[model samples]
Target: MNNTSVEKNLANKTVFPILFAISFSHLLNDTIQSLIPAIYPVIKHTFSLSFSQIGLITLVFQLSSSLLQPFVGLYTDKKPQPYSLALGMSFTLTGLVLLSLSANYHMMLLSVALVGLGSSIFHPEASRIAHSASGGKRGLAQSIFQLGGNAGSSLGPLLAAWIIVPYGQFSVIWFSTIALLAIIILTFVGNWYKGMVGVIKKNSHSITAISPFSKRKVVFSVSILLVLIFSKYFYMASLTSYFTFYMIDKFHVSVQSSQFYLFVFLFSVAAGTLIGGPVGDRFGRKYVIWFSILGTAPFALLLPHANLFWTTVLIVPIGVILASAFSAILVYAQELIPGKVGLVAGLFFGFAFGMGGIGSAIMGKLADETSISHVFFLCSFLPLIGLLTGLLPNIEGDRKKIKSNK
Candidate 1:
């Protein structure tokens, strides 16, 4: 590619609406998931929630999302379409709006469940679409889309901090609904409706549906990936759960200060996701995954030791390392089960991450009984799973043997 050609390619890249939708939907979904932890204290105090009940609320979101993702993936992989993507975002956006409006625990749980289901539909489909639209730049496209989630996750708390005080949590819903409505408009204007439906009907490839019980190689790879997934989730849930508390308890920072730092951590995640994809594309996906995982261990181990005013410089990198793993590994997991991208997305994102939330609750309960530092210690050791992942045989992102037929 010449300089002029490359420049044109880059310019053309900016005009893909399908890519925009995928990223926009991701931002909305992740904001909903990540924002809850920050606001839980407010809700807990209002509803008189105990520690376990708080964990249960988080667990409910993960469980429903995890359980529903596989079905969504199955349907999506079998028939890739844009409607599912649009519909999923609409559902997720609607759920977030409802979340802000909830007056009771039951209503909150119900709202979370909707967000979970909506997310379930969006992730796999958006990923698949991004990969397809990438036109051989799958890594960059995936990275861009992945960044949306991180961006939303980061923005959610900051927005909540601003809006929740004067207007309340329900006010956040208007933001999601309005943003989603724009995506809906963009979806039609971008002509994603006809394009995606056409693509779905065009798919006629045979996907190898290997049962995990029988395929040791695939299952073992999946099991190893699950370990990575679990560790990532622990980092996600535990960090969000206690980060503000840690700041207040250890550094004597005020609630507002701690929350700002927490937002910074999330924003770092957005940066990591945006960077990881291109790095993966330029290097190798395996290298990106393994390096980030290994890089995280030292950070995790060192988190408790940062006591000084300037130590947060160290904390930001740790957050990036922890967050970047998802974008790379998520794509890697989908690639592992080439013909079953949706199922794999569901299994990795929904199931493994869901199970991780349960594990996180256990750690939370342990914190209640034991020392929170001990919980962090246990969390640190979980990254050892990443070392083991290096041993799994790598796989291609898609079934090249069948692409010609498609």
Candidate 2:
């Protein structure tokens, strides 16, 4: 059969069972990943680590996660790996064991890198699975997949506060059960993936239709998307890596109280993520992208100036608005590139990780040199870059109309 015919057949088959499986695995995977950041205060106090040291920990973890992802995606694009996800989770299990046993700062960094390595392996291929299972509902599929990670992220601080903070660093070992659960789940996903590959092999030709836009236009559009990602993830780096610190510094809140506030912001992120995909599917992703990123400007600008109560209130909107852009952005990019789903997912995910890492490190240095308040003020302007959303081509109009008609 021709590529178009194969595309149609695949598009008609939305596999919810596999989607939910992968989404659940994603929750387990990210919950493990989020623990690294969530316990920063505990580790900082335990080891008497500096802010730069904390940033370096993120840098190491994120670099390990980011640097290998594109290569893994590229390799897998040519040669699909059905069982790699399960194997990847094993690495995470080992990392968790090591983290619990870590004696000092260096050990913690090494431990996190192993966890990062597992993440690098998991995301690109799992994303391909999501795409395969998407049928025609790419936005909703990506959103469902992302919602798990966001929810898991929201859970980390609370988990840390309840389990790790009260019980101490040794309590990290308790969470290793989550990794084992993911391994078993991913093993099942791998089986489903194996079956799906056979179907693709039987019916589909390698995807090679020329993109509607010229190569130059595609490159320019991707550049704009990457810039938007940088703006989003960099701003996120400030919040994710340092927001707890900011709360403690500015409000004199206790560590546990700061974590609770962090949980609120992250929960809002989960809620926003759930909304972005369906909305993007209904409307044009471009409009959703525009609103998701640029819409946060007012709240983001206000966050730094707010007093304690208002600061708490403001993060809800900030999290919701900023969190919405990613699903739209990922789906938009996939549409632009057509068949390079693995590569595209890898590049965007990797770049997002890289940007977040770099942002954390830079902000860490800035915070050390100046203050956390100054860092927030500087990041408030990052969202203004969203004005460039106007530059994205109007590619989704036909899809939007079709979706509307249905």
Candidate 3:
């Protein structure tokens, strides 16, 4: 079959369901990860943890995820996406379960580590499968997949709050129960892969020859995308860790009000996710990415100045839209290295994102020193570096150029 026919068949047969499965798994994974910070304050108080000790929780989580991701990526290259994905989800479910049952901070930390390791496995494998199914439309595919996670992260805090508000400390257990149930359902009812036979077979022999070090374009693209995505991850972690507290402490918003504003941010993310995928597919991925980054800076600066509920409401959407920028960058990374989709996905979204959490750990320390308000403004502008990198050139899917030298 011709490339166009193959592309069409892949899209029609495989794309949406796999993306949904990947998204669903990611949604559950990210929800728990996002809730960690919110849970931290309570846990710290309960356990009498020092500031450094509390920060170590994130440090350990990110370190474990980052360390394991490249290896996961290597394994994903050789394995079936479903196997890796299922294993990752299993790890996540197991970790959350352990966390639910934990009475001490050490056990809680171990649970977080388990969740991080599971995430390291899931992201690259699922993303590679999605990218292969997408033909060359990596950005749109990733955007759709990541939109699910953004929605999950956005929803998790509010959900945790709602449950915890009524049940207090026991709410974490309930969260784990929900994740466990979802895993069980997904395991049996999952239709995440429908036509993987052709797609996987076409690339079955390709992974052995794929090496990021040999491909200059892949290396350069990964480096640039890493910086771009790192900024996004740092912002996400910061928002997850600090935004609710910021609203409560700095703006004097009540906990309920703070949670409500978080929901506003999430709503905007959902809107951005819906908008980003189609827009990236149509008008070009670069514009969507640059737009999200350049656009978000002004909103970041405006956030500290906003006093009223309405003002906060407006800025939340800006943050949400900006969060969706990952869709463009991630897609770009995958397309830049076609055959090594798993490696690229793992490096960009998994390892790089974990590194971003490390950056957020530093940001958290900075928040302790200066104000998060001031630090966040600077973080907002960091995406500009990414915007500039996107302007470099279009090298994606240009195999003719790559093979021309031969």
Give the clashing residue pairs of candidate 1, or none.
100-170
Better of 1 and 3 by lDDT: 1
Error of 3 at 51 (Å): 4.7
Write candidate 2's Cα lDDT for 243-317 as tens digits.
999999998999999999999999999889977888998887899899999999999999999998999899999
Q: Per-prediction TM-score, please?
A: 0.84, 0.95, 0.85
Cα-lDDT of candidate 3: 0.66
How well does model 2 score by local distance difference test? 0.89
Winner by TM-score between candidate 3 and candidate 2: 2
List the global CA lDDT of all models: 0.69, 0.89, 0.66
Native-to-model Cα distance after best TM-score fit, residue 174 in candidate 2, in Å: 0.6
Give stretches of model 2 more than 4 Å off.
1-11, 202-208, 398-406
Output the better candidate (1/2) by TM-score: 2
Q: Which candidate ranks first by lDDT, i.e. highest?
A: 2
Give, for candidate 1, the lowest lDDT window spanning 10 residues: 204-213
* lDDT tens per residue, model 3, 1-406: 8975674566445356656766776777778766676565556667887545666788777766677666677676766545556667777777777876778878978988897887787677667666665655556677767777777777766876677544655667667765675566445323444346455656545444443234675566567667777766676666666676677767787665676667677667766875666677777667777777767776765766777665567656676677667777666665566556667666766656576668767877787777767766666666556556644355423444666755
> What TM-score number comes out for model 3?
0.85
